[model samples]
Target: MSDPTTDPAFLRDPYPAYAALRSRCPVQQVPTGSGGHSSYLVTGFEEARDALADPRLSKNTAAFFAGKESGRRIHPAVAHTMLATDPPQHTRLRRLVTGSFTTRAVDELRPFIARTTDALLDRWPAGGPVDLVAELAVPLPVIVICELLGVPEPDRAEVRRWSGELFASGAPAVIDAASHSLADYMTGLIADKRSRPGNALLDRLIAARDGDDRLSEEELVSLGVLLLVAGHETTTNFLGNAVLSLLLHPAELQRLRQHPDEIPSALDELLRYDSPVSSATFRFTTEAVTLGGTHIPAGKPVLVAIGAANRDPARWPAPDTLDLDRSPAGHLSFGHGIHRCVGAPLAKAEADIALRKLLTRFPDLRLAVSTEHLVWRRTRLVRGLTALPVLASRT
Candidate 1:
């Protein structure tokens, strides 16, 4: 089979492909985007969920990719973050930074989120066409994350440029370059913060303790890189995907418009309806493991399709339909178990505020372009629109 990662049709809507694969080979090797190395795509909800939490599947990319002729090197700063660590190392790294994502901390940023949303909406061309991807969805989270991390406002555009190039499918050279760009940026930022401290999440992380243990300089820099990259894309895609979903399902939009409070709960449904993340990061099997009655060999690269699992008919009734009231409690959009997204709470908070305000402020918000004319990015990692042109009613 041709590489689906680079396929235009597959990029637009992979759910059908996932369904087809799940029907016959839920756990089977597929061509990777890099044009080298075989990878397993686990599409079954149960299988995906279990594989995500299984300790037998290691997340250590450095160890797994060591000595491989993959043609790309995992940057040291990119490698040491919690997302790429196992057990003790992961636990320690996670403990040092979980405080900022707590409910209270997120709540404290409510005013800022509201301001950011309103400010962006204020710039909407008063009924003129605007690309929501660039005008709002892309920058809001970036700004919030920048402020949160003590990243200078002047440098966000460079940060964004690096992030934008990072998500492209299977370009090892581009990926390596982005990894280094971000790693270096974070390293410089950490050094600057140390010389002159401020009361920001970065400062707190620098000082955070895990029972006499602290994030080493490399871990601190790595965490900064992880948070910056993760913070920018996840919520941006979520917002874009959510708005696109709501626009496509007008009845659901009307339902939410009538009861704005539902928007909060509706987020869960939207997340499941069109998950921002198509698949969780790569996990390699440490030992032979049976999943969905299929035995996967050790030392094999595995990918859990989060988008596929959320839409699995066995778990979600009317799986393809947009039903805001459906229970989305167990959706794997943010993943599962210990490696689950640490920024999820903040992402949800941002989504909650962004959606409510966008809908309320422009009650007649509608897509400026035909649904079919919309272009999806050619990235296998994140399923999002490249440009979402919208018209806001300003009567």
Candidate 2:
């Protein structure tokens, strides 16, 4: 009925609101005012998954935004990225970058990820509180991704700052300005790669472009930004969130520590229980499509509530409770169908190594502050702590 963003009740924990909406009208259209208002906010498990796989719903926001008087212009650089492409193009664009995320490819990086984890932990003070997120989770992914993409070490910190602001929600002007700056930086990065090819993923992409014209120059540039952002941001949140959740549930943490192999399954449960991405990427309707007994008209945006869907009672028995043994294979944490995250294997590997290593290294690790003092990221989409302060015990 009201804008969910500003709703205090929704802010506390939106799952109740989502559950209520889905139960009452699964495909209800909530208004987003311009000339007209309505974007399907799909909340239910089955419906959200179905909508993700549907052909009628397009990811290319530029086309839909063009028809609507929403006053929002999709940046050309953002539009060229695969996230905004509908298939045939989405298919083509994804192919050019899939190799880096293949199971084989990700598996090969396991030892490196473990070493990175150990090294970060080793640097931690012998007996002191530390911000696990900053010292470990944040840098691990950025370093790994920078190495993977041939981003010069000197530019990594600046690029991460630019990328964070670009994805941040709210203040339309802020989003627009950040998007432009990121684009300019990406354009420059691509030029540098072209002039001096390094043995990095960016070089591989450039080589692919030169050899077969499969990816356009603009596409390569945008894809570089996407991979860097996607590769790091989400995993950073996942590691932080997983540690936060596990700490809150000490028994579960103890169980995982006892049987280290279960860390993989426990990671799945962490993903399903409290996903890094609370919602799927926004999608828009191309034509009037009736779903879940409600009709969403043509050219309207929809926010698929992935966190809500993951815990939908109809899909998972005892959904609200986190059960490590319960199979999370079908969860929408990595999304569903064709749009599913391609870098999932890498994300999983990084998280597994980070989480396991942290627990093992600091067997008596405990929170530095009260639970209420833990600050969450300002944006609701990527649910994570701003700081995860942990006291490392020598034992």
Candidate 3:
């Protein structure tokens, strides 16, 4: 198969490449532009799940190139985050933030979530031609994350803008600069929060720190920023994708409009049919491990293709078809095993509420432009349309 990374057709729509990978190799070693090459892509459902759960497959990218210095070039601070750690440390880091993400915690904020949704929707112009992304997708998560973190009202826009730049399609220079600026911006916020603690997540995290036992000053700041960026940005893509999907399938939109309770089921199909997270966070191998039918050498980076795995025919009866009623139990959109999304329940709640409300309010919603004319997010890890213009007049 061709390299999906650089292929324009695959970039336009990756399902074909994913399907090809699942059928042809299931697990294939591919080259990366990041100096080092030969990381395994687990395309099959069974193999992806197994690999995700395997303790032997380390999360530490540094371990992938123990001897070769060039291969392990990612920053140290980047490696320290929960996304890049293994066991013991990963457990501790995750524990510190997990309590805040529990169902009860998220449930308590439902009213707030709804309020935010309503507030953004209120801004939508009545009738034709509205950019769903800026009007809805952008504000909902920004407000939610700000409320969660106790980010002050004044700083919210800057934070949101920075986060957008950090995630939006861009050149390497643009991305790197955005990342550094974001980290620095979070550091400043952490300092300010420390001075006058508030009822937000940053304050709570700082208060939660017990002696030298809890997350370090750096970790706390990084975690706060990660939650802000990852927690909000990915969901933005999801909401955008959901809106795009529903716009494409008006029958599905009408179905959701009438039977609101089928939303959870519809979301399942939305997630599987066009998942937000294109690939799992990068994983590195400790020892040379054989996956799918291929042997990967020790010290190489691997990315589990969550998008591909979700559509593997071996797992779903008819992988290409969208079945809203299909059981959502084993979908890997939130991923599987240890590193599954910590804020998944919260994300689901937000999306479900937002989507159902959207369809119910605007039953005649349809894309204002052709799918071919729609520009998609480029360079970002998440797959989403740049803007989804919709006409909502029930004529």
Candidate 4:
């Protein structure tokens, strides 16, 4: 197979390529864009599921890339976040912050979410096209996360830039600078919280402990940095993708307009249909393992194609169809197993509120330009529209 990384068409619409690859075999070694290395891509639903939950597949970056210069690429400050660590560390980090997104906590934030959505919706000038991503998708999650993390209003914009620069596809030096910049910001933020704590999640993290096994200063900074970046990026993509998916399917949009209560299930379907995180972060094998009938050796980087697995025909009856009412029970959109996204509840709440309120407020919301003109993000990690200019109001 060709390098999917270099294909503009593949980047824009990768599902077709993912489907074609899955048809051949679920587990195939693909060329890594970096240094002639090969990584296994798991495309089948069953295979992806198994890969995500497998203990033999490790999340420790250093453990997998030991003795290789590849490990040095990551900024050491944020390298030890829960997403990059295995159990014990992962379990400890997750426990401290998991309560912040419990069902009750997310429910409590509904009023704030509604208020923020309304405030954003009120800014769109009638009869002029608005870039939905700039005015809405990006700000909503950023503001929510900032409020939750006690990020002062002045620093939020810088935080956003750092997060985007770290994730966006660009020059290596620029990306590395952004990574360290954001990590340094987090280090200072944690110290400030230490001096004067508040009720935000970051403050709680500072005080989190389990039988005297408290987080270290480094762990605190890494956790804050992780939350700052991961917290809003995925949701921003999800909101943009969800809106675009609806606008592309007018009938479905009409259905949502008619039954606003269906927004919950619709969000799930939207998530499965076009997961914000197209491909999950890499996992490396700890031992020889067989997946989808292919034998894989140790230390090989493995990628679970979350979007492909969600659309696997073997798993879903009509995989391509965007059926809002379809049950999205086992979708890997929020991932699976111990490392599943801790912010799933918060993400769902944000999408549900954003979509329902936007649709209700702007019944005529439609694309300002042709679908072909909409620019999709080129980053391999996240799948979303870069900008969604829309004629949101009726003439």
For all candidates in order, the CA lDDT equals: 0.87, 0.81, 0.77, 0.87
Give me the runs in candidate 3 sitting further than 4 Å from their true place.
Answer: 1-8, 34-36, 62-79, 168-170, 210-212
Residues 160-227, model 2: lDDT tens digits: 88767765656676667767777788789888878887888889988888889998888887888789
TM-score of 1: 0.96
Clashes of 4: 0
Candidate 4 regions exceeding 4 Å error are 1-3, 71-73, 209-213
Q: Candidate 3, residues 186-250: lDDT per residue as tens digits?
A: 77887888788888877878876634548887677678778887778778888998888776776
lDDT of 1 at 188: 85
Candidate 1 runs further than 4 Å off: 33-36, 208-213
- Per-candidate TM equals 0.96, 0.94, 0.93, 0.96
- Candidate 2: residue 383 Cα off by (Å): 1.8
Clashes of 1: 0
TM-score, cand. 3: 0.93
- Which stretch of 10 consecutive residues in model 2 shows the poorest summed lDDT? 3-12
Residue pairs with backbone overlap in model 2: none
CA lDDT for candidate 4: 0.87
| lDDT of model 4 at position 297 | 97
Ranked by lDDT, the better of candidates 1 and 2 is 1
